[model samples]
Target chain A: EADIYQTPRYLVIGTGKKITLECSQTMGHDKMYWYQQDPGMELHLIHYSYGVNSTEKGDLSSESTVSRIRTEHFPLTLESARPSHTSQYLCASSSSDRNTEAFFGQGTRLTVV
Target chain B: AQSVSQHNHHVILSEAASLELGCNYSYGGTVNLFWYVQYPGQHLQLLLKYFSGDPLVKGIKGFEAEFIKSKFSFNLRKPSVQWSDTAEYFCAVDIMNRDDKIIFGKGTRLHILP
Candidate 1:
């Protein structure tokens, strides 16, 4: 089984609230990523970290930011959540090897009302 | 910019029917391709992947995909599909050494008739 985990499987919060989606992986992977996906839609890359203390914005622009303080933890924070931010957030991790597959978390579904 | 494309938005098939899903990428150089499946209310999981060697890669649940480099396509196929196979399938591409991001297609929702 994949060791990645995300907190708050489901969340309903008021708009403008600052929220942080937690993601942690016990696989000791060097490549970690966060993707945003809507119901029945495609997954859009939002943030990724190559290694500890190295984070980069993904192809899709996102208002949220992520920090990789430790290899096992990567958290995404939304300064002020909006209705547009209501979507499922998925976390994934993979080894640095080019041939390896990524392991994914269960995902956190957020609802901003 | 590189992109992944899934030609079929949704597909409906009966049990024991042959299935095929088309996927194409717009990268010319070496790439690592993957197929991921997400069953209803479940997390995404790796169905299969192709990094090198044989182009025909078999995955879990009796699914397989062939990587045709000349056509820039990696199409997924299954001889006989079951109801448990109902899920959303995503095709992902990683452009080797050019970028660290893994781009995914819009995904095709597969529905199997019981």
Candidate 2:
């Protein structure tokens, strides 16, 4: 089983509410990523971190922001949640070793009403 | 930019039927290939991967994939599929000498009927 974990497996919040999705890993991986996915659709990378204090945006532009202050934790925050922000957020982590596979968390389903 | 493509959007098959899902990448240099499966209400799991030699790679749950460099394709196959095999499969590529980010394809949904 993967050591990565996402909090609040499901979330529902009103519009304009500030919310943060938590992600943590115990594998001591150097790389962490956040992806957005919809029902029956492909996952799109939104943000990633190489290590502490290192963050980069992914191919898909996202309104949310992420921070990697600790090696095992990478949290994403939405300034003001909107209906458009409603989607499934998945967190994953992988070692820096070459050819290694990535492990994923159960994912958080966010619903902005 | 490196990108992965899965030709089939959705597939339906019966139990004990052969299965093949097509995947192609657009990179010329060395690349690492991967196949990930997501069962219902479950997180994505690594089905198989190809990093170096041996184009033919086998994975868990009786799944396998072939990496054809000439065709820039890494197609997944299974001799006989079970109804429990129904899930979403994603093809991903990690281009060496580039960023560490792994690009994922749109994904293929497989539905196996009993």
Candidate 3:
């Protein structure tokens, strides 16, 4: 398994509440990414960070924001959760080398009702 | 813009069956390719990847993928599959241009019935 870990493996919260999904890796990789996926559906890139303090939105326009305060930590936050935010959030990290493969955390399943 | 496509959405097969999942990408530049698998209640795991060199790349769990640059396709194949192979498989592409922010296909769910 990847050294990456995600907190609150599963979460169910009320709509309009604020929440943050935590992701941390011990591999010391410089690149981290977040993807949103529905069960058995497509995985959409929501956010990514090249390194500390370098975060960017992905092809998918997500309402959530992400921060890369540290190399091992990347967190995604929702200002106001909604049903549309209900999905599996995946966190991954890879070495700075262009050819290295990415490793993924177990994922966080969030349900906003 | 780049895109990855998995032609098969859901597949049903019996044990010992040969497997093939089509994956094609649309990118005019050099890129990296990967296949990831996610079992029920588990996080995604890298099955294999092709960064350079040989067209055929072998991955974990007896799976392999062939990167056909001419076709702009990286299709995954396994000679013989087991019931344990049942899982959701995803094809991803990371163009060298964008710091390699990977893009994933809509995934293919395989069911290996015993």
Output the number of the DockQ-best candidate.
1
Task: Output the TM-score of candidate 2.
Answer: 0.98
Model 2, span B3-105: residue lDDT tens: 8999999999999999999999998988889999999999999999999999999999999999999999999999999999999999988777647788889
lDDT by residue (tens digit), candidate 3, B1-114: 789999999999999999999999999898999999989888888899998999999998899999999999999999999999999999999888955788999999999999
- Candidate no. 1 TM-score: 0.99
Q: lDDT of all predictions, in order shown?
A: 0.95, 0.95, 0.93
**Predicted candidate 1 versus true structure: per-residue lDDT over B14-92, tens digit per residue:** 9999999999999889999999999999999999999999999999999999999999999999999999999999999
* Candidate 2 lDDT over residue span A34-95, tens digit each: 99999988889999888999999999999999999999999999999999999999999999
What's the C-alpha lDDT at position B57 in model 1? 97
CA RMSD, predictions in order: 0.7, 0.8, 1.0
lDDT of 3 by residue, A1-113 (tens): 67999998999999999999999999999999999998779999999999999999898999999999899999999999999999999999999887888899989999999
User: Model 2: runs farther than 4 Å from truth?
Assistant: none
Docking class of 3: high
Off by over 4 Å in 1: none
Which has the better DockQ: candidate 1, or candidate 3? 1
DockQ, each predicted model: 0.92, 0.83, 0.91
